[model samples]
Target: MGESEQKVAKEPTEETAEVTGATVATEVSALPAEAPAVLPKTPPKGSKSYELIFLVDAALPKEELDALIAKVQGIIEQREGIVENVRVSDVRRLAYEIKKRTHGVYVVVNFFLLPSQIAELERLLRLDERVLRHMVICTRSS
Candidate 1:
């Protein structure tokens, strides 16, 4: 082919550029540059304090209850959480029956754990048959 014909063949036309997305790229490049987005700082992992309260069968012997509490503490420590305090209250009557039990022992634990690990901890608690009911709350604001 002649030099002019070769040039015409090699140069991309508007339809070819549009079909190949080259026109979109060029249009994007022609726009003004934008400043980088500023994201808010997040609290450090494992810095938040949380409170875990769980109820167990009131009929359980003291030794078994103690062991159960220790097991829960172990679960928290396994996830790199620090257990600050553990309070086991005397048997209390439940407002409503849970698992056909009207009485339960309430155990409260204060600990520091990563927010991401909270869901896993809850799942573990829910799966424990010994635990009649459980709830975790953030003890301190992030």
Candidate 2:
């Protein structure tokens, strides 16, 4: 093709660059200034809140049941963790049998502990035969 017929590529002009920069600046400035109001409160440093739910065999006697619960709380406290709350619900029929048991006791414990110690806590809970099933969930935003 001849030089005059060939298409030429043009670089962005000074005005084009200025307009792009101004558009970005305006978009950033449009964000809310009070962002903290919409954000969740951060927990204390080096610790996070977690909720532990476990199902225990309902056939256990009252004394043993109480002891097991206390033992779990003790484990958390022994590791320098704080127990916020413990809710023990009466034995209820399970949606499906767990370890051949139709009814089970539900225990919910909320506490704060270091993230690194979660594996150890879960290991200890798994060793107890009375606890049929258990789950740990983080309740606070990282």
Candidate 3:
């Protein structure tokens, strides 16, 4: 391009001006040197309520399913978790196939557990062949 075209291209437009203004404001209003750094707030040190939902292979026998549920309960209890409820739904057809299976047995577990132990529990579930899919969500009011 010519020198004039290059100069025009380099000129700051309204968008660039606004961006520069914001950047300047952000830099100037940053925390003062003497101010303490901010930290994230954490919940009190106690068990947190959570609901765990998982899908198991539908083809498993009733005895096998019971054993799987017992194994899950054991994991939670081993991690200082308290199981409040354990519900199992009948084997039903799935919307889409998983692991070449057309149906799954749905199980929902409500419990109080430490947040730190959730990862380990999920890891165990993931490694179990009986489990097809699983989800864990907080049930705390806050």
In model 3, residue pairs whose N, Cα or C atoms come closer than 3 Å (at least 3 residues apart or on different chains), thus clashing, are none
Cα error, candidate 2, residue 96 (Å): 0.5
Across 1-142, the per-residue lDDT of candidate 1 in tens digits comes to 6764322223323332311122332222222245376674444564698999999998987778777878888998888888877877767999999999999888889888888889999999999899998999998954
Assess the local accuracy of residue 139 in candidate 1 as a C-alpha lDDT between 0 and 100: 83
Instruction: Please count the clashing residue pairs in each candidate, in the order shown.
Output: 0, 0, 0
Put down candidate 2 lDDT per residue, 29-132, tens digits, no spaces: 23344445565434456888999999999898767877887898899888878887787777799999889999998888898888888899999999999899
Which wins on TM-score, candidate 1 or candidate 3?
A: 3
Instruction: Report each candidate's C-alpha RMSD, comma-separated, in the order given.
Output: 22.2, 21.8, 19.3
Q: How does candidate 3 score on lDDT?
A: 0.78
Model 2: lowest-lDDT 10 consecutive positions = 19-28
Q: What are the lDDT scores of the predictions, listed in order?
A: 0.77, 0.78, 0.78
Instruction: Name the top TM-score candidate.
Output: 2
As a whole number from 0 to 100, the lDDT of residue 112 in candidate 3 is 80
CA RMSD (A), model 2: 21.8
Provide TM-scores for the models. 0.66, 0.67, 0.67
